[model samples]
Target: MTFSIVGRCEETGQLGIAISSSSIAVGARCPWVRAGVGVVATQNVTLPALGPQILDLMERAKLGASAALDRALCASEWSEYRQVTVVDAQGRTAFLSGKQALGTYHAVAGKQCVAAGNMLAGTHVIEAMIPAFENAPGHLADRLLAAVHAAIGAGGEAGPVHSAALKIAGEQSWPLVDLRVDWSDDDPIAKLDGLWQAYRPQMQDYVARALNPTAAPRYGVPGDE
Candidate 1:
């Protein structure tokens, strides 16, 4: 009941994942990225724990994305019911679609991105997302927004999408961009796009505030101290 792309920006080495689901709060679950580590998306039956655990492996355990996934899946009893895709810091990628994952599911990997979906309109849903990410111009965040919108343009999920999320991690431990529409009456992709547009200008300000508040500019809507 979801579609997503996990990708890295070649110029910046930033990691990002964009996702939408019929389910609420996909942000709190499906996508995980760690700076200098890797990216993970856990969907289908949705083993939310796998997202973080895999990142731990990539970080602390020093495992590559494929090795981390292979090692983790080898020890799991529920592997047959979950779908997972991973992209490491090196841009190497891997995908798994469990046997019991519901409805038309597919995974497509590319130059620096991987697109995956289950309970989708068809395989082409994921197919359309890949080049959209690869070919999209500008920042990594914009590329991701383009990919999710392309997924929807290609017919999207089998049902109406109620929620969506876009997350990008830069050199910081925290996400540089994390936008979501936990529930939307209309299109969540456009909602997320609007959110990104609003947030993009302030992105560097937030980072600067964290790194060096003395030099960070205040937009002046609220108290500036």
Candidate 2:
């Protein structure tokens, strides 16, 4: 069982996906993003490759989120069992809950964002996320965090969630933020959020180190000094 929000920041042009699930390592299998392209979450009976396939359609084939999703599903033999969401660079959104989606499932689309889930407590889980994302402040990552928290507060999955992930794509080819709590007996979402707070301050430093090492700041750790 899984739930996710895929979004694009209109102001910063950042793209990201935040997800949590009863399954372990949900992050590695469900969320995918491209900095200047789009974000995708493939859950339920997850076909992880669908994430990149949708992105390829959006980026190389010049397709929008809806068209890309359609094309991706058209090629999938297991589309009937998948729950997927997409948010394009331009903030256009699309999502699908297949006929075979487990338990309770729903999807909600807001400005520049889409929230979707399968095997959820109820539709309220997704309904609560859109408004939270729309009104939340700070970076795209912050808004995504708000959405994830709101979903949990409203009523999360049908069962306890053991894993969570927050992934964001910015100017770099690699993810600007890729945090995951692969499995936790307690609250994985809270742990994932804590990781975000710890990572946020060093985010820019890491980016600078990659882009221009000569101008980047020192690590300030024992050996780096």
Candidate 3:
């Protein structure tokens, strides 16, 4: 049982995905981001490799989100069981919910976001997410998390989801923000939100350290001193 939101920040050109599921470690197989390329979320009998495959088409093959998703699914033998969403660097979006995607699957693509859910409480789950993200104020990550929160608030999976993840990519090859609650029955989204708040201030600092050591701020650790 899974639901996700993949989006782009039209203002910043940032792309990322936020997702949660009743399964354990959903983060490991779902959300995927490529700094300047796009974001993808493959769930409901997921093929994790599909994330990179679609991203490859968009990044190197220069395809838009729809065409990229087309090329990736064409090669999949189990496409019927998968639910996927894609958001390109240009903020274009596309998604699919296979005939065999399992219970109560629904999806929608709007402005700069695409949301999908399977084995959900109801259609209202995805419906609630889009407007929250669109109206929420702040960074893409905040909006993304808010979207997931809205989904969960609307009614999450058919059962309890023990894991959640948030991933955002910027100018670097790595994610500017990557947080996960691999297995927590309590509330993974809330935990992820706390992690984001703690890491938010250091995000730019870490990026600066990677790009320019001389100008980067000191770490205050033994070797750093």
Candidate 4:
């Protein structure tokens, strides 16, 4: 029913995640990320609290991605029914998809990223995503988006995807960029990619202004200035 990618951006040092699902509002239900803390995507009987708890542990430097996930899983009564992927501030990645997860559910952890999904055509969906993310160029968000595309190409969620989203954060709890396709008739991945591209310039401009507001106005036209 869902597919997701969680990763730390190597270039910007920002952690980001993206997800799409056949279910409505998948963004709101599946993807979870904290700027400098970590990233999580809990699906297959989603436990939203697990997202923050794992992030809190990572923020306190109490555990890495693997250990944090292990702790969370061990403490949960429904652990076997959950699928989760985590990536810490340091870019360490880990993932677990319970044995009881829906058909075709699986997870993959890479050098600094993790991708997971459930209710798909086969495990190959997630397997293709791992390498796509690893070999993808550009910022963290772009790579995460690429992984989403790969999964969709690999047969996506045993059904049509209706929702998609991308999240990134750093230094603050608030998201630096959060874009969602709550519902779409067209290709969700391409729509998401277009959204990312459209948002990039604006996001860069906003960051620039926030970092150096005084200099930002200088880039405007002379008459406007």
Candidate 5:
């Protein structure tokens, strides 16, 4: 089972997704984002390919969130078993929870975000995330994480979650923030938050290093100065 949020930062035009699941390596399969395009989270009998297909439609075909999703689903032979969510750079959102969706599934859309979960503790788990995302401060990654925390507080999935991921696409083609906890006996969300905190401070520095190495910050390791 999986619970996820696909979001856009109106302030920065960044797209991202935060997700957690009872399955392992949830990051490797679900949650896809393209800078200046959109984000798609494909779960519930997860067809990993559907994620990229949706993104391709949005990026290359210049399709909006709903159109891209519709076309992608039409192409998917196993669409009925999938639960997917999408949010474009313009903040348009769409989602589908199939008739065959797992127990107690729910999906909700908010200002610039969509939260969804299958085999959840209750629909309230999905409901609680919307306000959290709208109100959270700091970066888009922080807001997305806040939504995930709210879902957990509202009683996340019907079962324990073993893996979690946070992905954000900025100006570059690559992810601005990509963090994952593949498997954890302890609290994976908490572990993911810790990783975010550690990465946040150095996020822009890494980007500068890639774009203009001479202007980038120092590595700060021994002898680097």
Candidate 6:
């Protein structure tokens, strides 16, 4: 049903996730990340609860990503139907693909990243994502976008992807940058890329405001004037 990558940027310390799926609203269903906590992408049968549950456990103590994922998998009723990838605050990464997952579900875990997907054309789909992220130059968000693009080129989901998203968090739980293409007639991944490009300027502006509200007026708002 979906393919996703969850990771942290070694350069920026920004935690994020990028996902695409044949299902509608894949962004809402597949990807979740909490900056300074961890990232989770729950696919296949898709246990949405595992997203926050894993993060909560990691927050309670400084557990490694694998330990947290193991604990969560043990507690879930649908463990056999779920595929999850997690990267904790310390940059440790982990992934689990259930035996009962749909066709070709797989995962790759690296020191700084994890890529996972189900219903893919082949195992190389997830493998391509890792090097794409590593070779991509720029911020965490850009690298995530590259990973998604790589997966798409590697044959993507077994079916057409309808939705995609990218999420990044910081000191606050609220996403610093969250962009989604819920449904698209065009290439959803490309649509997501365009939206991300358009949104980056606005996102930067918003972060600038948050850092220095007094400078808001300079950007042409009424208060700054």
Tens-digit per-residue lDDT, 112-155, candidate 1: 88899999999999999999999999999999889998999999
* lDDT values, one for every candidate: 0.91, 0.95, 0.93, 0.84, 0.95, 0.86
Report the C-alpha lDDT of model 6 over 101-126, residue by residue, as the tens digit: 99988899865899999999999999
lDDT of 5 by residue, 1-225 (tens): 899999999889999999999999999999999999999999999999999998899888999999999999998887889999999889999999998999999999999899999999999999999999999999998999999999999999999999999999999989999999999979999999999999999999999999998898887799768
Off by over 4 Å in 4: 210-225
TM-scores for every candidate against the unseen true structure:
0.97, 0.98, 0.97, 0.89, 0.97, 0.93
Tell me the spans in candidate 6 whose CA falls farther than 4 Å from its real position.
217-225
Report RMSD (Å) for each prediction in the order shown. 1.0, 0.8, 1.0, 2.8, 1.0, 1.8
Displacement of residue 159 (Cα, Å) in model 4 is 0.9
Give the per-residue lDDT digits (tens) of candidate 2, residues 54-76.
99999999999999999999999
lDDT accuracy of residue 193 in candidate 2: 94
Model 4 C-alpha lDDT per residue in residues 24-99, reported as the tens digit of each score: 7777877778877788888888887889878877878569998998988888888989998999888888888888
Which residue window of length 10 is worst by lDDT in model 1?
216-225
State, as a TM-score between 0 and 1, how close model 6 is to the true structure: 0.93
The true-versus-predicted C-alpha distance at residue 165 of model 3, in Å, is 0.6
lDDT of 5 at 86: 97
